[model samples]
Target: MKKSDVLEQIRKIGLVPVLRAESESQALALAGAIADGGVTCMEVTMTVPGALKVMARLAKERPEILLGAGTVLDAETAKECVGEGATFIVSPAFDEKTVSYCRAHEIAVLPGALTPTEVIRAWDAGADVVKIFPASAMGGAKYLKSLKAPLPNIEMIPTGGVSLATAHEFLDAGAYALGVGADLVDTKAIRGGHPETVTAHARKYMEIVKGFQAGCLI
Candidate 1:
């Protein structure tokens, strides 16, 4: 998908499921569960084992869902993930090399940033969006809201401590979208071999987010 299209989809969905799978099989199942729950965007973090291979499988098999690689720290991994069919890229920390690599390749990049300086640096580095990592530590929605006054143009995705209940608050506070991990996709449920539980949890979050978007609670 085109970068513009991917960004638009992320804005529409309001939340992107972040998955860390121990194996390819588990990743496949997680992808299916998220997709089934009405969320078509996912971020597969490289922290998990076989992340690249799992990302490749999801890209090839689940063409309907937008696939992104998260926790990307360097140029090599960024290049490999994009080549393997990552529609977009995300990083835990601001990395100039990684951002430059994505920009050179014309792939969308969302590098994690905290302060205004870091956020601006990421944008200046050509990041499609700046992820506010551990946003809760920075004061969550209130922090994002504070930045809007001075840096309204910076697109941000608040990850870490973003829950289904507070997802809309971040969006309303000026976040472009949210990168949800454990809150949306229960790792314990998945590890327990209850993929359906994951699906159900995803569906609940999706409904809450979609409802807020539609301006109808019920």
Candidate 2:
């Protein structure tokens, strides 16, 4: 997909599920469950065992899903993930070389940032979107709102504290999209043979996103 199109889908969907699993098989199962629940875009964190294998399989088997690589700390790792079919690169913190590489490759990059300075630095470094990592630590939606006030031109994806309970608040804070982890991914439920639990969570989040977007349209 074109870089522009990938970013458009992200904003349209308004939710990016962050996937992390203990095993490759479990990761696949979690991905399947999330897709079944109506979320087709996700960030597969490198922390998962056999992360490249998982990304390859997902890219080959599920062409409809938008796959991204997360926890990418360096350009080398980002290159490897892209080779495995990651359309986007996501890092927990800003790395100039990694961001530069993605930009040079025409791939979407969302590097994480927290403070105002880091956020600006990431944006200035050409990040398509700055991900506010561990957003809960800085007061969640309120913090995001503060960032958006002056940096309104910069897009941001708030991660680490988004839940069904707070997704709406994040959207209201002018977040470009949400980065949801355990709350929506639900690996435990998948391991317990309840993939439906994940699907249900996806449905709930989708409902929130769709509802918010619909309101915006009106």
Highest TM-score against the true fold, candidate: 2
- TM-scores, one per candidate: 0.94, 0.99
Residue 133 miss distance in model 2 (angstroms): 0.9
Cα lDDT tens digits, model 1, 111-188, are 999989998988987989999988999888999899777999889998987887788788788878888888766667
Question: How well is each residue in 14-65 modelled by candidate 2, as lDDT tens digits?
Answer: 8899999999999999999998888899989999999999999999998888
Tell me the TM-score of model 1.
0.94
The superposed Cα distance between candidate 2 and the true structure at residue 45, in angstroms, equals 0.6
Displacement of residue 20 (Cα, Å) in model 2 is: 0.5
lDDT of each: 0.85, 0.95
- Per-residue error (Å), model 1, residue 58: 0.9
